[model samples]
Target: MRTVPGRLRPRSLRTRLVLIATVLATAAVLVCQATGLTLMRSWLVGQVDDRLTDFRPPEPVYRDIADGTAPAHRPPPHETLPSDFRVYFYDADGRLLPASLGSGRGEPHLAEDITARDPADGRPATVPARDGGGSWRVVADSGPDGMRAVVALPLDSVEEATSKLLWFSLAIGAFAAGGVMLLGGAAVRLGLRPLTRVEHTARSITSGRLEQNVAGTSPDTEVGRLGIAFNTMLDQLRAALHRKDRTERRLRRFMADAGHELRTPLTSLQGFAELLLDDPDMSPARRREAHELIAQNADRMSRLVDSLFLLAKLGDAPTTEHGPVDLLSLAADGIAASAARHPDRRIALAPLGAGYGADPAELDVVEASGDPHQLAQVLANLLDNACTHTPPGTRLQVRVGSLRAGPRTGGTDRPGRTSTGPPLPAGTPAQVIEVADDGPGLTPEEAQQVFDRFYRVPPAPDALRDSGSGLGLAIASTIAEAHGGRLELDTAPGAGCTFRLLLPASGGT
Candidate 1:
C-alpha cells in the first residue's frame, strides 16, 4: 500500500472545469423546467377558465328566457371547432343536455358516465372518462333566468395545448442550458491560457533549451500575473544554474592551475634528486647543497598543493555539519609557522582600531564554526600571502577580532539585516582575522583583482618574478567564502596589502 505521485494519473484542469460547468448547466435546466412547468400550468388554467366563462345555453332558450317567457326545451352550451371534438353537456338536474350550436357526442359520449349531482356554482373539476382516453370538466351554476345549469365538456384542446407547451418549454430550456455550458467551457480555457504558455516553456526546458524563458507581456487578466510569476521562477532557476556552471568552470581552472604550480618545483626537485642518486663522483659540499635545494622546492610545491585542495573543499563541505573551531589559535599558529619556516625573515604583530589586538597571543581563540582542516587552510593562505609579498626585513602583522556580516552581500550595517562576525549561520556574525604586510604591496587595480584566479602582481624590471602559481590568493578567497564569509583586501600603490578572513562565529546557527 504505497502511494506515489509518479504513479498516479494527474487530473486535467480543463476537463475538470468543463465537467463542473456542465453539471451547473444541468441544474439550471432543471430549475428552468420546473419554473416553466409552473408558469404554463397557470396559463393553461386561465385558458380553461376562459372557455368555461364562454359557456352559454342554446340561443332559442336564451331568447325565450330573456323576453320573460318560459322555455319549451332547455339545451346545453357548446363550441364548434370545425373538427372531431364532441360537445356534450348536463343540466343542473344531472340530465343530459342538448347542444343547439354544435354536433353532440358521437354514439355513446366518452364523458357520459362521469356525471355529478349538480356541481356547486363556480366550482369545477376534471374527471377521467372511460378507458382513460380523455377527461371531462363538470361545472354547475344558476342560468340567466335564475334556473340551475350544469356543463360538461371534453378537455382535449386544453390537454393537447398543455402537452405541446411542456415539450416546447423543455426544448427551450435545454437549448439555453447547452449554450451556457459551451460558453463556460470557452471561458475556462481562456482563463487558463497562461498555463498553456507555462506548459510550452516547460516543454522547451525538457528539450534542451536552457535559455528559454516564459514571456509574461500582453496578458489581459490575472493570467498575466501568472505569466509574470512563472517567468520570475524561471529567472531564479536560471540564475542558480548559471552560478553552478560558473563554479564548475572555476573548479576546472583551479585544478589546472594547481597542476601547473606543482610542475615547476617538481621538475627542479626531480632533476636534483636524480643527480644525487647518480653514481658519478661529486664533492660532498655540492651534493649537500643539491639535496637541500631539492628539499626546499619539494616543501614549496607541497604547501601550494595543500592550499589549493583546501579551497576546493569549501564548496564540497556540508553546511552546518562541522563543529566550532577557535580561529585565534589557528591564525596565530599559522603566523608562527610562516615565521619559523623563514627564520631569517622578519615578522611583526600589529593591532587595528576596530577591537583587533596587537599581541600575537592577543589573537584569542575566537569561536568559529567549520571544518578545522579547511579553516586552517584559510589561515595558511593568508600567511603565505604575507610571506611572499614582504621584503626580508619588512614587518608582518596578524590581528583577530569580531564583526557583523550583513545579509546584503553588497555590504550594509543596518539592524536585523546585519550579522556579527561571519555570514555563516544562515547569515550571521563572524570571527575576522586580518593579515597585513609593509612591503611595497598592491596598486588599486591589482588589489581589486588579486583574488581572481590566475591574476598576479605586475612584474617590475628588477623585481623578483612570482615563482608560485598565481592561484594562492584566489584559492584563499574561495575558502573564506565557502565558510560563509568573504575575503576583503586593503591595498594601494606604495601601501602594503592587508588580507581579511571572515569566518562564522560559533553559536551563530
Candidate 2:
C-alpha cells in the first residue's frame, strides 16, 4: 500500500483543467491586442500624411506669379486649406516668412495681416502654435517680387480625433473578447452533451449491473472513448461479484449438508439414551455401557451441529443487535464442558499470570458488545478445537482485552477482535478475545486456510483420527465477522496456537 501525504497535497483535476484553458485564452488575447494596435496606429499616420500632401494653392495665386506683379520673393498664396495641414514659403533660406492669403494659390486665415507686411522679406517667420503642442507643415516658394508665402495648421485636431478612435477600438475589443469567452464555453459544453448522460449512467452501476452499459455509436470521438472505458470497468466488477456470490452459496450448502449428516446420529443417540433410562429390568453393566455410548455420540453431534449452524447463519442470517456478551465467561464454560466430555483427558485453564486465580482482579472478563449466542458459538468451536488437538494435560488459555490500533486505524477501538478488528476508527476503542491452546497447533499456511469452509488439513501420519466436520473454524470466523470483527491466528507446526477475535468496543458510534 502507498501512503498518502497531506502536507504536500496533489493538485486537483478541476484546477489543472481550468488553468490550462485560462492560459491559452490569455495568450490569444495578447496576440489580438498587439495586432490591432499596430495596424490602427499605422493607418492613422498614413491618413494624416495624405491629407497634408493633397493641399494646393488656388488659381489666382498662380496667375499673380505668372504676371510678375506680386512681391518679388513671395510665393503664390492659398485661398483655403484643411485644418490638419500647413504650407509655408521662404527666399532660399529656412526662415519664418509671411503668409499671403487669397492674392495667391491656397486659402489662409489672416488676409489683412499678410498684405500689411513690407515687400522686403528678411525676418524669421512663426505660426502661433495651437494648444502649445501642435506640429506645423511648412511649404516655401519665391513669388513675383522679393516676397515669400507660408501656411500653418495645428496638429492637435488630427491627433485628438485619432486618439478617440483608438480608445473606442480598445473598448470594443475588450467587450468582444469577454463575449467570445462566454460563447466559447457555452459551445464546448453544448457539444459534449452526451458526456453528462454517460456520467450519470456510470454512477448508477458501481456494482453488479452487468446489463447496464453506454451504447455509444460515435467511437471516433473523445467522449465515446470515455464511455467505452467505463463500460469495460463495469464488466470486470460484475464478473468479480458473480464469482464471490457463487463461492458464498457453495459454502452455505456445505454447512447445511454436514449439519443434516451429523444430526441423524445425534437423534438416534438421544432416543436410545431415553429408552435405556426407562427400562425396568436391565442389568447395571448393560445400562451403563449403552449410557456411555449414547452420551459420547450425543456430545459429538451437539458440538458438530452447533458449529455447522453457526456457519450457515453467518452466510445468510446475521442478527443486527450487538448487545452484552461475556466472551471470557463463554470461553471458560466451553473449557469446563469439553473437559467433562473427556473425563480420561485432563483439560485445565492457565491463570491469567496473576497466580491468585480465585480473585476477580486475577481474572480477565472482557465485557464486549455482541450477540451472546454468537459469541458462545465462537468460544465453543475454538475451545473444542484446543481439546481435540493437544495432549490430554495441556493448558488452554482465553484472554479478552481492549486493542489499541495505530495511526493507520485512527486508533479507535473496535469491540471484537479475532484477527482483524473493525477498521480501526481514528479514535475508536476496540475489543479482542483470544483463545490459546498448548496443543500441537497448525502451521502458518494451515492456520490461514483453517477458517475456510470444508478446508480440512490432513493430520500428521502418526497422529490420531480427525474429529471435526471441517466447518468449526470456518463457523468461528463467521461469527467473529457478524460482530464486525476478525479472527487471526498465531502458531506454527509443533507450536501452540492462539485465535484472536477483534471487534468494535462499547461507546463506539
Candidate 3:
C-alpha cells in the first residue's frame, strides 16, 4: 500500500496531541472495563458452582429412592428449583432415575451420567449443556440413600450479565475518548499559545514588519525560551537591515561625488582642447598655455580615477597585506617632500615630546603593523592637504608619537572624540601620527565633513579651491581604515585643524 508524505500530513499540533490522548484514554478505559467484566463474570459463575456443590435432596425423596418406590422422569412438585435452574438424578449404574411421584426431581431430556470426571481431581465435574437454550453447570455426588444424584444450574444469567457488561465497557470507552479529545485539545491550545505568537510574528516579518517581537512569558518554560530566541533573531535581522540601508546610502553619495569630480576635469580638458583647436592664428604663448591647461586637467582626472579605484578596493575588502612600517621614516619623508614642493611654506617635523609619555628614542623608532605603501600615502595626503589649504608661510608640523593613553594623549577640540581603531589587548600601546598646521582653522561643519569624498573646505576668501580634486582626504581615510586604524580631525574657528592617524604599534619587545 502507498503511504502519504510528511508534508501532506495533518499540520495541527493540537489535533495530533488530542488524538494521541484520545487513543490512550480509550485503551485505558477498555482495559479497565475488560478486567472488571471478567472478574464479575468469574464471581457470578463461582456463585452458581457453589450452589451446585452444596445441593441436598429432601429426606422423603431419599427414602423413596432407597426403597425403589419413587417415580422416574417426572417433574418435581411445587417447583422447588430456581426458575432458571434444573436438578437431575442418576442411578448407581449411571442410568436416569425417576423422581418421587409428586416431588418433580427430574429435568426432562437431560441425560444421566452427563458429568465428566475432572482431570485434576478425578471427581464428577460440572458439565455445561451444549443446547442453544443456554448452558448448565452440573455436579454429581452420592446422596444419603446411596443413590447417585446430579444438581444443575443454568448459565443464562451469567451470559446476560456479561453481555450487558460488554456494552457498558464500550460506552465508557467512547465517552472517555470524547472527553479526552475535548479537554486535551483545549490544553494543547493553551500551552502552545506562545508558539502561536511566534508564528504571528514570523508572518509579520514576512510582510515587512521587521520590528515586531513575541512577548516572552518566563525563561524557565519551553515556550518562553522559544520566544526569547525568536526575539533575539528578530533584533539581529533588524540591525543587519539597518546596516545594509546605511551602506546603500553611502554608495549613492559616492557615485554622485565621483561623477561630479570626474566631470570638472573632463570639462576643463574639453575647454582647453576647444580653445587650442578654434584659433589657427593663436600666438605660440597662448598655445603653450592651452597645452599646459590640458595636461594639468588630464593629470587631475588621472589622480581622481586612481583615488576612486583605491577606495573601491578598500571598501570591498579592508584587510590587506601587512608588515612592519617605520612611522618616523615615513613621516619624515612625507614632510621633506611637502617642504620641497612648497618652499615658501614653513614645514617642520616634530618628534614625540614629553607630552607623548615615551622615551625620545622610542618616539624616533615608532613602528606600526600595517601596509607600508598605504601608510605612506596617508601621510603624503595629509601633508598635501595642509599645505594646499593654509596660507603661504603657515607653520606646519608632523608629529610622530606612541600613544600610551590612546586619543587622550593630545587634548582634542571635542573632549572625548578619538580616531577609530581595532580594540587592542590590554597594555598594548597605539602609534599616533598627526599633521598639525597653524593656519586659518575650520568651522565645525567643515570639520565634520572634511573626510567625505568630493568635500572641500570652502576656500578662504583669498584662496582658490581649484588646487584639490577633493578626493585626497577621503582616500587617506580609506587607507587608514583598511590598515585597521582611523583618521580623525580636530579643529576650531581659530585653532588650526589637526588630522590624527591611529594605528596599532608593532610588538618588538
Candidate 4:
C-alpha cells in the first residue's frame, strides 16, 4: 500500500474542503456572469434594431427621389439626422440614386450588393460596411412612386458597451473567487479543530499514556458525535488492556507457584533414590519405608498435576453430562464417605433450613442438571477442606435443599463476613448444598483468596500432617462453575465457615 508516493493525495482535510468549496463557488459565479453578459449584449442589439425600425426620412426627400429630380450629391439643408445614421434611395429598376441623407460624421459606407438587392419586406438586417470600417443595422421600406428608402445605424457603440461590461465582470469574478478561497480555507480550519485535538489525544495514548482522553464530547454536530464515539472506544480499549495486563500477572504467579509445588515432591523422590543408591546393604524394613515415602510423594504430585489439568480444561470449554441429579442424595453419599474416611470428624446431614431454624421434617429434595461424578467431587472437596482445617470431632453439617427466590437463605451479613462467588440471580430457581462447620472460620482476607489456585490457610501447629496440596477448593470452584453454579464461602474470623454450592434447580418450583 505504501508503494505509491502520497504527493498527489491531499494530506490535510482542511485544504481539501476549502479547495472543493472554492471551486464550486467560482464555477457558479462564472456561469451567472456569462449569462448576464449574453443577456446584456442581446438587449443592446435589440435597442439599436428598434431605433432603425422607427427611423423615417422627410416627405419632400422621398417625393423628390420618386420624381427622379432629387439631387444625388447630398440631402436638403432643412433635413438633419443623427451623426451615426445614414439614408440611401433606390429606384424601381434597383439602381442607386446617389444622393443620401446623414450628419456626415462617422457614417458607415453600405455595400453595393446590399443596395442592389430588392428590399423584400420592412425588417431590420445587419450588413457589413463597404469600406470595412464596421457593421450596420439597416432596414428598407417602400416609398412614393416605387422608390425604396434604406436607413442604416452604426453598431460600434453597442459593441463598445458590451465589451466594457465583459471585462468588468471578469475582474469582479476573479476578486470573488480569491475571497472565497481565503475565507473558505479559514472556515474549514476552524471546523476541523476538534478533529485535530482528537488526533493529539490518540497520539498520546499510543505513547503509553493510557489515561489520556478526548475533550468536547457533545453529540450535537458531526464533529461532536465523532468525538463521543472516539472517547467511548478509548475507554473500552483501556479496560481491555487492563484486563490483559492483570491476566498476565496472574499467569506468571500461577506458573511460579505450580513450579514450587512440583519441586518439593520431586526433590523428595530424588533424596530417597539417592539414599537407596548410597547404601546397598539397607535392611528390608528400611527399604520398604523408603519405597512407601517415594510412593506417597508420587501420588501427591499426581493429584496436583491432575488438578492443574482439570482447572485448565475447565477454563477452556467445560462440558457436562446433562441429567437430573439429586443434591440431597449426593450430599448423603459424600457425608457417609467422608465420615468413613475421618471417623472422628462427626460429619452428618443437616435438616432443611437447619441453620435457619426450620423443622427437619420440612426438608425437600434438591435436584439439578449436571454430571454426577463432577458434583460428587465438588462435595468431597468441600467436606475434606472442612475436615482437614478444623479440629477432630468438629460438628460439620452438610445441608442440601432448594432456596426460594429473594433474600439470602440461612445467612446474614455481619462484620468481617465475606462472600467470594459469582452472584446467583434473585429470579433463578436455585438449589444449594452447603457444608458448614462449627470450627474456627477464615478472615475476610483469607476468604477472598480461598478460591485461587494453590492457596491454603496457614495450618495449625499440630495439623501439618493433614494439610492438603491447596488445590481442593480451587478445583471444586471450577467444577461448580462448569456445572453452571458457583461455590460461595461465608465466613468470619472465629464465626465458622459455610461453603455453599448453588446450582440452578432442574425442575421448577
Candidate 5:
C-alpha cells in the first residue's frame, strides 16, 4: 500500500492475487490427497481380507490316521500357509486339539459367536488369542467328519502398512503443495504486473498530477484497455476542472464590472440630489435640471440591472414562451421602428435569394421557432446598435431570406445587402437575417470581442462616442444561442460590419 495525503489504501494487486492463488492451490492439494489416501487404505484392507479368505490347512491335519473319522479332503502343507496366519483344530465333540496336531496356534482361539456347524462363511471376525496376544481376524470351516478348523491372522502387519502409506502420502503431498504454492504466487505476480503500473499512475493522479498516464501496453489485453479508458476519463476530468476555473474567473470579473457600472449612476444621482438639498435658494430651472439628470441616470441604472439579471436567468434556463415566429416580419417591424427612433438614418428592408431578389417590401416569409418577445428584442438590439454607431443618414438594410447557403461571409454585396457563405446541408434550410450599414466597419480585434459581455470598441479620436451599455450584442447573442441559433459578425477595418442572425427554420415555412 502507498500513502496518499489523507487516504489509507488496501493491499496491492499483486499481493491480493498471490493470496488468492495460494488458497486455491491449497484446496486442490487437499482434495487430491484425501482421495488418494482413501483409495490406498481401501486397497490395502482388501489385500489383508484376501489373505484371510484364501488360507488352507496342512495335509496331515486333514488325514484321519490318528483320528476316529476319515478326512473328506486333504489340506495343504504347513509351510504353504501365509507367514502371519495360524490354524486351530477341534475334535468331534468340539474339544480343542493340542498344538502337536500341527496347528499353528497354541490352542483354540475362536470367538463364542462361531461354532463348528456354523463355519464362519469367510466373514471376518475379530478374535482374541487364548494366550492373550494382540487382535486377530479369524474364520472357521468344517473339516472331515465331525472335525472343525479355524484360521486366524494378527492385525499389526496390516495396520502398520496402512499407517506407513498414509505418512508417505502426506509427506509427498505436503512437498508438492508447497512447490505449487510458490509457483502459483510467482505466476500471479507476473500476470498482474500491468495492474501495478495502473495503480501507480492512479496514485499520481490522486495527488494532483492529472497529466500522468499509463502507456506502452498492447490495447488487446484487458489491463491495457482499462488503462486507455482510465486515461480518457482523466482527460475529461481535467478539462472539466479547467472549464470550472475559467467560469469562476469570468464570474468574478462580471461582478466587478457590474459594480462599476451601477456605481457611476448612483454617484451621479447622489451628487445632484445633494446639491438641491444643500442650496435652499436654488432656481426652479436648476432644480428641474437636477431632477431630470437624476431621473436619466436612474433609468440607465435600471436598464443595466435588468440586463444583468436577464443574462443570469438565460444561463440557468431558456425562455419557454415559444411559437412559430415569422422572422422576416419581425425584422421588417424592427427596421420601421428604428427608422422612427433615428429618423436621420436611411433604414430599409430587402429580400435575398438566388436571383438577387427584386423586392424589399415583398420579402420572402422566413419562420423560426423561438420566444417572439426574445426574438423581437434581438432584432431591436441589432437595429439600435447600427443606428447608434453609424453616422446620421448612413443607409442600413435588413435582408430576410431562406438561406440555402448558411451564414454570410464578411463582405459587402450591394449598397445595403451583404452576401452569405456556402450552402447548408441539403433539405435542412436555415433562415438568415442580416443587418448591414455603411458605417465604418469594425477592426478585426473589435469584431472578435463585440459579442463579449460589457465590451465596447475604443472610440475614434475626433468622432462622437455613442452612449451605450455595451450589453446589447451580448444579450442578443445569448438569446440567439438559447434558441439553437447564432449571431455572427462579418466585418473588417473600413468595411461596414454585417451582423447575421442564423436560426433554424420552423416547421412548414
Candidate 6:
C-alpha cells in the first residue's frame, strides 16, 4: 500500500478535525451565497421587465408614427415615458423610421435586425446595443397602422447592483471560513488534550517509569475511557514485573540454601571415607563406625535432592490424583507414625471442640476430595514438623474436624504472612486437620518465614542430632494448595504453634 507523504497528510488528529470542519463550513457558505446571488439577479431583472410591460406611450405619438408624419429625433407632445426608457418606431415595410423618443441621455443604438423582428405579444427580450453603451431589455408591439413600436431599457443598473452583492458575499464568506478554521482548531486541540497526556504517560512507562499513570480517568468520554484502560494495563504490567522479580529472588535463595545443605553432608562423607582409606591398620570397630557415618551422610544427601525435585515438580504444575480421603483417618495414621518415631513424645488424636465424641473411632469424619497419597503426605509432614521442632516431652495433638465458619481473609499483621487464602464463606463446608504442639512457640518474625523452604528454627542445645530437613512445612503447604486448600500457622511468642490445613469438604460423612 502506498502511504501519503507526511507533508500532504495531516499528522495530528486536531489538524484533521479542524481542516474538515472548516471545509464543510466554507462549502455551505459558498452554496448559500451562490443561491442568494442568483435569486437577487432574477428578481431585479423581473422588476425591469414589469416596468416595460406596464408603460404605454401617448396615443398621439403612436398615431403620428403610423401616419409617417412624426418628427425625427424628437419627443411628441404629452409624452410621459420614464427618463430611463427609450422608444423607437419601425415602418410597415420593416424599414427603420428616423423618428424616436428618449430621455436627454445618450441613446442606445439597437440593431436593425432586432427592431425588424415580429411583434412580441408584449413579452420582453434582451438584446445587445449597437452603440456599445450596454445591453438593453426591450419589448415590441404592433401600433394601430401596422407600424412596430419598441421600448428599450438599459441593464447597467441591474448588472452593477448584482456585481456589488457578489463581491460583498465573497468577502463575508472568506471571513467566515477563516473564523471557522481558527475556532475549530482550538476546539479540537482542547478535546484531544487527554490523549496527549496519555501519550506522555506511555512514553514514561516505556522508559521504565512504571509508577507513571495517565491522569483524568473519568468513564464519561472516549479519551477518558482510553486513559482508564491504559492505567489499568500499566498497573497489571507493574504487578507482573514485581512477581517476576520475587520469583527470581526466591529461586536464587533456594539454590544457595540447597548448596549449603548438600555441602555439609558431602564434607562429612568425604572426611569419613578418607579416614577409612587412610587408616587401613586401624581397629575393625573404628572402620565399621566410619563406614556407617559415610552411609548416613550419603542418605542425607539423597533426601535433600529428592525434596528439591519434589518442590520443583510442585512449582511447575500442581496437578494431583484426585480421590476421596478421610482427614480424620489420615490424622490418626500421622499421629501413630510420629509416636513410633519418638516414643518419648506424647502424640495423640483429639477432638477439635467439645461437640465431638470421646472415642477416637466415633469422632466425626472429616472428608475431602484430593489425591489420597498427597493428602496423607501432607498430614505426615505436619506431624513430623511438629515433632521435630518441639522438645521430646512437649505434648503434641492431631485434631481433625469440619470447619463451621470461614477464617479471616486479609493480610496478617505479621510481616512475613500474606493474605489468608481466599475467604471461605461462612457456613461453607470444609475439612480441617490441625497439628498443635505445646512447645516453645515462634515469634512474629519467626512465624512469618516458618513455611519458607529449607527454613528451620534454631535447634535447642539438647535437640536430637537427626533434627531432619526444614522442607516439611513448605512441602505440606504446597500440597495443601494443590488440593485446593491452604496451610495456616497460628502462633505467637510463648504460645504453642498450631499448623492448620484447610481443604474444601467433599461431602458430609
Q: Whole-model Cα lDDT per candidate? A: 0.63, 0.60, 0.73, 0.80, 0.71, 0.77
- lDDT (C-alpha) at residue 30 in model 1: 71
The TM-score between candidate 1 and the true structure equals 0.63
Q: Write the per-residue lDDT of candidate 5 for residues 51-139, one digit (tens) a residue.
A: 87787664566564335353322234443444666666676677655432233444335643435556655776765656765567767
lDDT of 1 by residue, 362-398 (tens): 4344677777876676677677666665556667777
Position 505, candidate 5: lDDT: 74
- Model 6 alpha-carbon miss at residue 423, Å: 6.1
Which candidate should be chosen as best, given lDDT against the real structure? 4
Per-residue lDDT tens digits of candidate 6, residues 1-509? 68866657546777778888988998899899989999999999999999988876766887887766767666776665687888887776766677787765456565565344464658888877666556788887777666777888888889899989999989988998899999988888888999999999889888988899998788999999999999889889989999899989999998899989999999999999888788899798988888888999999999989888888898787766787788778887877877788777787787665223455554687677888887788888877777777776877878877665443421122332332355455666677787788788888778878888888887644555566778877888888777777788877766778777778776642
**The best candidate in terms of TM-score:** 4
Instruction: Assess the local accuracy of residue 453 in candidate 3 as a C-alpha lDDT between 0 and 100.
Output: 78
Query: In model 6, how large is the Cα lDDT of residue 321?
Result: 79
Return whichever of 1 and 4 wins on TM-score: 4
Those runs of model 2 whose alpha carbons end farther than 4 Å from true positions after fitting are 1-236, 239-307, 344-365, 406-428, 459-466
Q: How far is candidate 2 from the true structure (C-alpha RMSD, Å)?
A: 15.2
Off by over 4 Å in 6: 1-10, 31-166, 186-231, 276-284, 322-325, 332-347, 350-362, 404-429, 460-464, 504-509
Per-candidate alpha-carbon RMSD to the true structure = 8.7, 15.2, 6.6, 5.1, 6.7, 6.0
lDDT of 2 by residue, 80-192 (tens): 44544444443323333443332322333322233324422323222344334444333333454444555344445456765776676666657655665676556656766
TM-scores of the candidates in the order shown: 0.63, 0.44, 0.70, 0.76, 0.74, 0.70
lDDT winner, 3 or 6: 6
Tell how far residue 498 is off in model 1, in angstroms: 1.9
Worst window of 10 by summed lDDT in candidate 6: 410-419
Candidates sorted by lDDT, best first: 4, 6, 3, 5, 1, 2
Tally clashes: model 1.
10
After TM-score superposition, the amount by which residue 79's alpha carbon in candidate 2 deviates from its true location, in angstroms, is: 34
